[model samples]
Target: MAWAGLQTALQLIYPPRCLTCGGMVESDFGLCGPCWRDTPFIGGLVCDLCGTPLPGVDDGVPVHCDSCMTTERPWQQGRAALMYRDSGRRLVLSLKHGDRHDVVRPAAKWMAHSARPLLREDTLIAPIPLHWSRMARRRFNQSALLADALARETGRTSCPDLLIRANRTRSLEGLTRNERFATLMGSIRAHPKRTALMEGRSILLVDDVMTSGATLAAATEACYASRAREVCVIALTRVANES
Candidate 1:
C-alpha cells in the first residue's frame, strides 16, 4: 500500500513520458506505441559466447564473435542486452550522462531478463568500478546504477567494490585492441575486504557497456586472482562494428 501510494504521488507530481520519444506515457516505463515497435529487443539465435547476432552457424561449433575467437577473454562468458545502435546508445547515455534515474529500472529489468537463463542460483553480482577521479566528477557510477537495479529485481546482493579501479586510463574510443588491453591490464584491483566473499563464488560482472572486452577481462582477472571460481560478464550494449 505504501509503495502504491508512492507511485501514485510520483505520477501525480510528474507526468511520465517515454524515455525514447518523450511522448506521454500512461504508466511508468510504458513506452509510446512507436517506441515500443521500434525498440530493438535482442532476441533470436545469438552468439553462445558473446550474445551477438551471427550470420551463419554450424551445430556443434562454439558460437563466438570473430574478436572473441582471436583474443582471450578473462571472463567465462559475456552477454549483451542490445547491440550498440542508436536506441541502445541513446538509452545508455540518458541514464549515464543525463542522470535519468527513472530509466535505470527498465534498463536493469531488461538486463536481468536476458541474464536470468545464464545466472546461477548462488551467484554474486558485482559492477565494474569507476576510477576515483571519474566517480568524483560524475558523482555516480553508471555501472553501479545498473547493478543496483538488477539487485532489486533479482533479490540478490550487489557488491559494488569487489573490484576497485587502481588507476584511470585514457578514453578507449580510438585505441587499438592491443592498446586497449595494455591500458586496462593493471587498472583494476580486487578489494581486500571482500576477498573472502569472492573465493569459490560464481560472479556476474556487470557494466553499462562493452566495447573491446578489455576492461571486463582485466576486472575478471582481478576477481580470479582473488579466488573467484567463475566470472561471467553482462553488459547493456556492445560495439558491433568490426571496422
Candidate 2:
C-alpha cells in the first residue's frame, strides 16, 4: 500500500505528457484534449485493399479506392492506424528520428487494435526492414521496434529476420508509382535460412508509415516468393492521397 501510494504521488508530481505536443496528459503515451482531437485516426469506410479513407459508405460491400482500382497491391489487405497528416506526421517523425522508444508500445497497441481484422491464428508479424547502413546510422529500425511491440501485444511471432533488405534505394517521395516500383525492385529479399518458416504462414507486415505502398509491395513480393500463404500490411500512419 505504501509503495503504491508513493508511486501515485510521484506520477502526480511528474504527470505524463502528450506524445505529440509534450503537454501534460492523463496517461502515458497519450495526448492532451486538443492533441487528441487533432489526431487523424484512420477509421470509417476505407478502401478494401489500400485502406485509404473513402468518401462514403456502402452496403457492406468492399470498395476499392482509385489507386487500388487501377494499381495492383501485392498485400492482401492494408490498414493504417492514423492518416499521415499534421499530428500523424509529427508522431511518426518523432518515433523515426527522435529516438522516442516510449512511443512504440502505445502506438503498437493502437496498431494492433486497428488492424485486428487482419490478424489470424498463425500470422507472423514482420517489419519492412532497413538496410544495414541505414540501420547503423539510425541506431535502430523503427519498424522492427514497432513490430516487436505489436507481436507482444497481439501474441504473434515477431519475425525480424523473415525479410532482409538486400539493397538501399533513394527516397521514394515525389516519385510516381512506376518509378517507386522500379527503384524498389530487387531491393528486398526473404532470408534464405528462414524462408521455410514462412512457407505456409500468413504474414502481417508492420511499418511506421505507408506512403506509396512501394516498400510494402516489394516486401510482399519477397514474402510471397518464399511461398507464404498470405501477406497483409499495416502501419501506424498512411499518407492519405485524398481527403
Candidate 3:
C-alpha cells in the first residue's frame, strides 16, 4: 500500500512523535496513548436532530438546540466527533496547516463508526466545498480529504464535485452570529452538471470543523435546492454550547 510505504518512509526520516506530548510513538498520526485517551470523544445525551451533545437524551425536549429551534437546517440530521476543545483544535490545525493528512484516517474512522447506521448503500458522501481560490492556495481541501477517508472506511462513494462554493466570503472569525449567517447564506450551490444525481438521494456532507453551523446550513440548503431528499452532515468537531 502506498500509505504504508509513505508511513514507513516518514518514520524512517522524521520518526513518529505524539502531537499532544511530543513523545515517541509507533504510528505516523502523532498521537500517544495517553493523549488519544484524553481526546474528548463525544458520546451520551446527544441531540436527535443535529447530534450535538445534549444535556439529556430523554429530557423530553426533542433533542434540538436553541439554534436548531430558531433556524431551520435543510439537512435531515448530523453528528460530530467532539466539542471544539484544544485537542480537536490541534487535530484540525495539523490536518489543515501542518499537512498531517495522516490524521484523516483516525478521525474519519471515528466518524464512520458513528455514521455507519445512518449510511446506506445508496447514500452519497460529499464534502463541503472550498472556494476555488482557497483550494488553489491550500492545494487541498481538508473536507475532501475527510470525505475520501470516510468513503474508503464505509464503502460509500465520495462525489467530489457534487457541491461547490459559488463565492468566496470573508472569514467568519470575530463576526457576529447574524453576520456569519448572512455572509454564509447562499454561498454554496450544487454543481450544475451533477444536479441530476442529487435529487431524492441521501447525502453525507463531510467537514473538518463546524462553528455556528453556518457553513453546514448553507451547504444543506444547496443540497436540498438541488432536490436532494435528505442531507446529513458529519464533522470532526463543532463549537459546543454556541447558543
Candidate 4:
C-alpha cells in the first residue's frame, strides 16, 4: 500500500510521456496512439532467415524473402521487432545517437516477443560488438544495451563481451552489399575468454538495426567458430528494402 501510494505520488509529479512524440501517455516507455499507428511493427508472414515482412499469411511453415533467397545468412534463423522506417527509424536513431537509454525497456519487450520462436533452454544472448574506437566515441553499444535488457526479459544469460571487433572498419552507410560483407569479413571474432560459455549453446545475437546484415553475419560466424551449437538473431528493426 505504501508502494502504491508512492507510485501515485510519483505519477503526479512526473506523468508518463510518449517515447516518440513526448505526448502524455498512460504508461512509461510507450508511444502515443498516433505514433503507435505510424510505427511499422512487423507482423504476419515474415522471412524465416532475416524477418522481413512477407506478402502472404503465416502458414506455420518457414519461408524466405527474395533477399534471403540469394544472399547467404550465417545465422540459422532471425526476427525483428519493427521495419526501419517512420517511428521505428526515429526510435533507433534516438537510442543510438541521442542517448535515449529509456528506449531499451520497451524495445527489449518487443524484441523478446519477436524472438519467442528462437529461444531455447541453452540459449545465450550476445550483441553485435562495436570496435573499441567506436565504443569510445559512442560511450555505449546500443546493441549490448538491448541484448542485456532482452536477456532480463527472457530469463536468459547475457554475455555482453562474447564477441569483439578485432579490426576497425569504416562505416557501412553507403557501402554495397558486397563491399559491406568484405569490410566486416574478418572484423569480428568471439572473445577468447568467453568461448567456453558458447560451446554447445544456441547463441541469440541481438542488434539495434539490420541493414545489409553484414555485421550480424560476422557475429554469427564468430559464434560458430566458438563451437556454438546453433545461432539465431534478433534486431530492433530491419531495413525493408536494401538499396
Candidate 5:
C-alpha cells in the first residue's frame, strides 16, 4: 500500500498528460478522448502488404492495396499503425524531430498490435538504419528507439545495428517513386559482424514512416542478402496517398 500511496502522491504533483495534446489524462502515454478520436489509427480491413485501410470487412483473408499490388515490396508482409495525416502526422513529427522520447512506449504498443500477423516465435526486430552522418546530426534514431521498445513489448530480440547504410543518399522528401527507389538501391546492407545473427531467421524491419517504401525495400534486401529466411516490415505511419 505504500507504493500505491506514493503513486497517488506523485500523481497529485505531476498528473499524467496526453502524449499529443498535453491535456490531463487518466494515464500516461495516452491521448484524451478528442485526440484519440481524431488520430487516424489504422483499423478494420487493411492491406496485407502495406496496412492501408481498405473498404471491405476483414473476413480472415489477406488483401493488398492498389499501390502494393503494383509496387514490388521486397518484404513478405508489412503493417503500419497510422496514416501520415492529422494527429498521426503530428505524433510522428514530434517523435522524429522534436525529441519526444516519451512517445515511444505507446507507439510501440500500437505497432505491436498491427504486427500480430507478421510476428513469429523467433522473429528478430531491427530498425532501418540511418547513415552515421545523419545519426550524428539527430543524436538518436527514432526507428531504433521504437524497434527496441517493440521488442521489449513483444518479448522478441532486437538488434539495433543489424543493418547499416552503405552510403549516404539524398533525402526522399520530394522525390518521385522511381527516383526514391533508384536513390536507395544498393545503399543499405547488413552489418558484417551482425549478418550471422540473421542467418535463416525471420526479421522484422521497423521504421518511423514509409513514403515510397524505398528505404524499407533496401533494408529488406539486405536481410535477404544475409540469408534471412523471411522479412517483414512495420512503420509508425504510412503515406497512403502520395500527394
Candidate 6:
C-alpha cells in the first residue's frame, strides 16, 4: 500500500486543478466542466489519411478530405485526438509550454483512443524528435513522453530515438505546402544504430501537434528510409484550418 499512500500524500500536497483556469478539478489531469465543454475533440467523421474533420456525409465510412484526395500523405494513415482550438489549444500549450506534467497521462489516454484503429500488436511506436538546440531549451521532448505512454498502454515497443532531428527547421507557421517541403527536407534521419529496429516494421509516429505537417512528413521519410513497411501518425491535436 506504499504506492497508494504516496498518492494520497501527493494529492494532499497538491490538490487537483484545471489545466486551463486553475480551478479545482475532480481529477489531477483535466479541465473543468466548462473547459471540457469547450474542447473540440475530434470524433465521428475525419479524413482517412490526415484525420481532418470531414463534412459528415460518408455515414462513418472512410473518406478523404479534398486535400488528401488530391495529394498523398507519406504515412499510410493518421489520427488526431482534437482540433487545435479552444480548450484543445490550452491542453497542448499546457503540456508543451506550461510544464504541466500532469497533462501527459490524460492526453496520452485520449491519443491511445484515437489511434486504436491504426495500432497493431507488432507496431513500433516512435516520437518526432526535437533538435538538440530545442531539446536543450525545453528540457524534454513532449512527443517522447507521449510515445512512451502510448507504448505502455498498447504493449508496443517505443523507440524514442528511431527518428532523430539532425537539424532544426524554421517554424512552419504560415508557410505554403511547397515552402514547407524545402524547410523540413533534411531535418530528420533515422538513428544509425536503431534503424535495424524499424526494418520492415509498421510504425506509429507520435507527436503533440500536427501544424503544417512538415515535421511528421520528414519523420515519415526517415522511417521509410529505414525500410519500415508502413507508417501511421497520431498527433494529440492538429491544425484545424487549411491555411
Tell me the TM-score of each prediction against the true structure. 0.92, 0.94, 0.88, 0.99, 0.98, 0.93
The residue-by-residue lDDT of candidate 1 on 1-243, one tens digit each, is 999999899899988899898889898876788887776666655665566767764464557777778878777777888777778888888888898887788888888877875588778899999999999999999998898788888887789888899889999878888899889988998988999989998888888888888888999999999998898888888777643
User: lDDT of each model, Cα atoms only?
Assistant: 0.83, 0.88, 0.84, 0.95, 0.95, 0.87
* Residue 110, model 4, lDDT: 95
lDDT per residue (tens digit) for residues 1-243 in model 3: 999898788788998788667889987655788888888778776765566776754553447777778777777777888677878888888889999887888898888976754687678999999999999999999999999989999998999889899999999888876888899998999999999988989999999887778899899899899988888888888787663
* Location of the lowest summed lDDT over 10 successive residues in candidate 5: 234-243
Worst 10 residues of 4 by lDDT: 234-243
What are the per-residue Cα lDDT tens digits for candidate 4 across 1-243? 999999999999999999999999999889899999999999999998999999988998999998998999989999999999989999999999999999999999999999999999989999999999999999999999999999999999999999999989998999999999999998999999999999999999999999998999999999999999999999999997796
Measured on C-alpha atoms, candidate 3 has an lDDT of 0.84
Error (Å) of candidate 6 at residue 188 is 1.2
Number of clashing residue pairs in every model? 0, 0, 1, 0, 0, 0
Greater-TM-score candidate between 1 and 5: 5
Q: Which stretches of candidate 6 lie above 4 Å from their native place?
A: 1-6, 57-60
TM-score of predicted structure 2: 0.94
- Cα deviation of 206 in candidate 3 (Å)? 0.7
lDDT of 5 by residue, 1-243 (tens): 999999999999999999988999998789999999999999999988888999999998999999988998889999999999999999999998999999999999999999999999999999999999999999999999999999999999999999999999998989999999999999999999999999999999999998888999999999999999999999999897863
* Candidate 4 stretches greater than 4 Å from native: none
Off by over 4 Å in 2: 1-6
The full ranking of all candidates by TM-score, starting with the best, is: 4, 5, 2, 6, 1, 3
Question: 154, model 2: CA deviation in Å?
Answer: 1.3
Please state the error at residue 76 of candidate 5 in Å. 0.6
Summing lDDT over every window of 10 consecutive residues in candidate 3, give the lowest-scoring window.
Answer: 54-63
True lDDT of residue 195, candidate 5? 94
User: Per-residue alpha-carbon lDDT of model 2 for 133-219, expressed as tens digits?
Assistant: 998999899999999999999998988878899987898877887898899999999998989989999999988988778889999
All models, RMSD in angstroms? 2.2, 1.8, 3.2, 0.7, 1.0, 1.7
**102-178, model 6: which lDDT tens digit per residue?**
77888888888889889987899999999999999999999999999989887889988888888878877778877
Instruction: Flag regions of model 3 displaced more than 4 Å.
Output: 1-16, 26-30, 57-62
Clashes of 3: 1
After superposition, the stretches of candidate 5 with alpha carbons farther than 4 Å from their true spots are none
